[model samples]
Target: MMQLLIVDDEQIEREGMKFILQKSFPSLEVLEARNGKMAIEIAKTIKPDLILMDIKMPGISGLEALERIMEFSTDIKFIMVTAYDTFDYMRKAIKLGASDYLLKPSKAADIVETVGKVLKEIVVDKRSRAASKRQETVIQKTRSIIEADLVTQLLFEHVHEVNVDLLIDMLEIDRNHEVFVMNVLVPDSSDHPYPLIKEKVSELGNCLVGALSGNQLPIIVFRDKNVSFRFQATSFAKKIITVKQHHEALGWFIGIGNVYSELNQVKKSYQESLVAAMEYLSPAKYRFYAEIEIVEEDFFDLRLTTLKKDIVDQIKLGQWEAIRTEVLSLVQFFEQQGASLVYSQQRILEVLWVVSRVLNDLGIEAKSPLFAFQTIDYRQLRMETGQLLDLLKQKHIHYYQQLEADNVQQIKQYIQAHSHEEISLETLSVEMGLSPIYISKLFKEKMGINYIDFLTECRIEKAKKLMQDPRRSIKEIAIEVGYHEPNYFSKVFKKMVHVSPKEYQNAIHGK
Candidate 1:
């Protein structure tokens, strides 16, 4: 219920106004104050929705009380009640934020009309504020989804050219700013503390937290120009550790990757972070990519880097033989380098772990690559590593053998059918029971174009068909063909069709 307070020095005046208000607005909770001071106190206590103040009052004038009350409660509606109808008095009341003025000898109808107008305004203001708050909440949720999707695209899948840049802009991160990936390994038994970890990262204000995938939670931290990289990474790692310490049973490990200036290159950082976490025997809760004790000269060799990338690419392409050959070759290179047996095995395990991660990303569940026992000789190492590779190959083959032969056809059909809606690789991934990366690779290889390109083609073709209807507006056609913004729709149409949407529409109708 709305509350109104009447303030006047004369008790009869206050009582008369309250009686009239109570009779007109039976539901209104009417309050009374004999002076401006009392009016301020009542407003502060009861927080009334409206106030009626007499210009003439003891101790403090009506305008003075209006100013005092407004200082603390700007939402309260005010009406100045006075006998004087001078322009000066009206101006002063208006200047002091009075909602409406009530002449001292006003009729009951006039009193009710003025109070009702102010009350209606208060209700409208409340509704508008509520709507704005709801909009803000929706925007926050949409942003979180976009952030998660962006992280997935950058780390696990090919970035779609049509939306990745726009998404980066929407996320408001400077592309010039460097970024690094932090991978958190949460044990399977512990209740996933994703919300708590996200809350802690949000305090830093520049991190994008990805959805928890199995046991790994990835965070991309933007470099702060003022802070050293180590300081920022260390501080955040400690905060994550603090969250982990709360759950003693959960063995949480964090891996910090090397910093990269380009967003696209951050995938490499993600890979490094995974390798860093491979050292599960480390006493510390967190490990940095740079802290991996492998000899720097051998570790940073360009040939090794290229070979690792090849293994990742081959895994996505489902070329198990190629992947196996690459793994053994990598082992051979390490052997010829005269690296220690333990060090070589560790490096080989790291490479195998990368393979396991890539397979996991492709929606293929593979066990973490580990040798049965520490190898004491090069021959034993090769035999054990080969066996692990063969096991992984069988898992990959088994997963694909279960998939429908025409998965690509199904994806193409889905896009063609749903082109008029918001479609993304992530959406298709969910629908097809495949990872976005695997779907993207398959679509490109089989269809000879990116999935996003195919989706755009479908939308544009539909838009062309829609354009044939002379009755439809360009904006309506854009919306019907899945583009929300007419301007962007027109831009894409021009790029693909070699003419603007309007120009094409004009040509078709001879307008």
Candidate 2:
């Protein structure tokens, strides 16, 4: 309910104004303060929406009380009341932020008009603030969804050319900065610790925490120049571990990857983080990829670069025969180099792991590639590696066999139909029963655009149509096209259409 406070030294004046306000504004709660001193006290405690102060009062003057209240409560509206209509008193009241003024013997209609005007302003201001708060909430939620999808794109799937840059722009992160990946492996299914972990990570520094995919949670940490990489990564990992330490039974593990200057190479860092996470037997709960005792010297040979690319491409293409050829050829090259069978097996295991992860990105949940037993000789090594490849290939084949050819089109239609509602990759993943990573990959490969871009296109197109009607406001058009905040809608529209919504509307009307 609205509250109004009447401050006058005369008991008769306070009572008269209270009765007048109560009769006209039946809903307003009237408060009484006999003097400026009492008025200050009541204003502080009650925080009335409006105050009618008699200009002259005992002890503290009305102007003094208004000034004191103004210091603490700027939102409270004030009106000056006095028998004198002198310029000095009127000027003083105006200087003190009084909204309106009244003569001591004013008519009942005049009193109601002035009080009702300020009351209307208070109501309008309250509604505007509430609307702004709701818009902020919606924008925050949209940013989170975009951040999660960006993490998935960078780490788990191939980056969409059109969407990646736009997503980074929307996230307001530096694209050229170095970044590393961290994999937090939750041992169980409970998601209770995810929010705690994300909150702690945010407090530490800038990072993007992804949604939980199975038990694995990925985070992309931008490099902070103020601290050494080791110190930063170690501190971040330890803090994440502390989140679950109280539970004791959670058994969470963390893996920190090496920092890379390029975003595309971030996937390599993510892969390294997964490899580091596999050091579950280590004494420490967290491990860095560089700290792992893996033989990467031979694995980094320039000769293998082209072959590695070929293997990745072939895996995505599901060219099993070509993939097998590349694997055997890599092993043969290692043998010709006089590399030991153990080293060859290690390198081949790395390749197979990459294949498994790539298949995982394609919606095939292949088991982590591992040899059943150590190969004693090169012959046994080749045989075991072939068996592993065959297993992965069969899973890949089964996945494709069951996937509908029109799945991408169906997803496209769902987005087009629901462009006027909140849509996120996670939501589509749930509805289609596909991993978000796979959905992203499918958009890039089949549609030549990411789903985010497609969704934006749908929204902008709808907004353009709505703009054709001169009767509709930009904010109304924004809501009709799925954006909750008009400013955010304008930004997206401007980014996609090369003009602000107002400019577009003006152009349409020949303004």
Candidate 3:
């Protein structure tokens, strides 16, 4: 039932309007106001769905009263009641947010029809306002969650329960039927796209529901039919728009999760979307799935198992070429299998992820020169794939060369130039102007050989060169390479070069 307030200065006009409304809408509850001032007060107190006001009231004109009433509650639909039908009066009432104007000598049926139409409109406006409020609340909570960095916190606690059922209830989804869980993540700080982000995702006009995950990440949850492939395509497009909008706005990275049948899968999708979003680190990525290509393979899946082991071995051996080869091979295999761009990128990321782990185990930084080069945002360059790849390769080679030519090479040069002197790690550090520990780490990474081992190899090679001259004794040659004590030098030479100093000399002379 709808509630209405009837306002007029004359008692007969008020009663007549009330009778006509009540008779027309038997379910409507009519309340009477004799003057404009009284109508404003009654509207404030009663909060009716519609207000019927006479324009020529004594205390305050109906239009004046309607203006005041709007201040109290703009939601109430007001229709001006007047004996006059001037264009000026109609314009003034509408400017004040009045629904319609009814003539005082108006036909009963016309007044009834106008009242009924205004009532229906008010109901619709009320519903829309309610939905808008709900969405704002969700946005607030999601923003709070993402900014809080709760992703790792939730994962570590093994707490998968995200109160999605309550959220679904708040979203007013029909509980009787099942809804597919679609999670979308945009790469912008705003959390969603501007124009198209909020558009309906399906023919039924179902909307996208989203919030921020604990990791300062945005997660959009929506529902549609999985049986219809067209629905899936539409859903993908909607999420892509969100990603594109955010990237355009804030240059953020966006990720999208695979479609899931159950709400329980939302958490997994949430995690995967985060990983997918990280692809922004490498640009021009698109919608990807979390569990789509995951096939259950036991230990007996020898082909993949062997491939994994091969990549792992090459990483451990510090064979950068082998690591690069195995990854490219895997990517090629997947591409040949008719994998989409999204699928290929996912596989490549997986390979890089493993490589990053191995580098970390070898005490390398988590982010490598290769990773950084591959991830440079090329959108600013406006370059195509071939150009971008060429640029990436140029950068990769430069960094790789820099990595190889760094402190280790400097240390190697210092060692060689001072082979005739008593050079130590301390002396080499001073010559290179680098801290001893820092030099050691650089040596290990670039040369794939430790400091003491390289120094020993250098000393032994110098000793051999000196021993080539028949005039040089084993002790003299040892002394020349910074070894003062012949016995200690001989011991070191034997240990390093696999022969006693005298034996080495004899072998060189064929004595």
- Runs of candidate 3 exceeding 4 Å displacement: 1-143, 146-258, 261-264, 267-319, 332-346, 349-511
| lDDT (C-alpha) at residue 486 in model 1 | 95
lDDT of 1 by residue, 1-511 (tens): 5689998888888888888888766557898898889999998999998999888777998888999999999888899888865547767889878889988788987997788777767755654555577856655675677688778878875555534654575566677779999998776554658878988888887888888876688999999879899999999998887787666644477889999998879998998897776655457888898987675454545655676678667876778888778778867877887887766776787777667777886799975665545578888988999999888888888887656447988998999999998888899989999999989888887778999899999999999998898889999999988999999999999999999998999999998
Better of 2 and 3 by lDDT: 2
- TM-score per candidate, chains pooled: 0.47, 0.43, 0.29
What are the RMSDs of all candidates, in order?
20.8, 22.1, 27.4
Question: Order of all candidates by TM-score, from best down to worst?
Answer: 1, 2, 3
Error of 2 at 497 (Å): 66
lDDT ranking of the models: 1, 2, 3
Q: Write the per-residue lDDT of candidate 3 for residues 1-511, one digit (tens) a residue.
A: 4589888777888788888876665546899888888888888788888888878767688888888888878888888876664557878888888878887588887986788667667645655675677855654454333322332232223332323332343334454432333333333344434334433332334434343332123333445445463355445555545546335542344465655555444556554664455455444444454433443223214534465667546654546555555546655555456554544454455445444444444444443112223322323111233332333334445554565587667778887877767766688778888777877778887778887778778888988888889998777787778878999988888888789989988997998
Worst 10 residues of 1 by lDDT: 295-304
Of the pair 2 and 3, which is ahead by TM-score? 2
Total backbone collisions for each predicted model: 0, 0, 6
lDDT of each: 0.81, 0.80, 0.59
Report the Cα lDDT for residue 174, model 2.
79
Candidate 2 positional error at 220, Å: 1.7
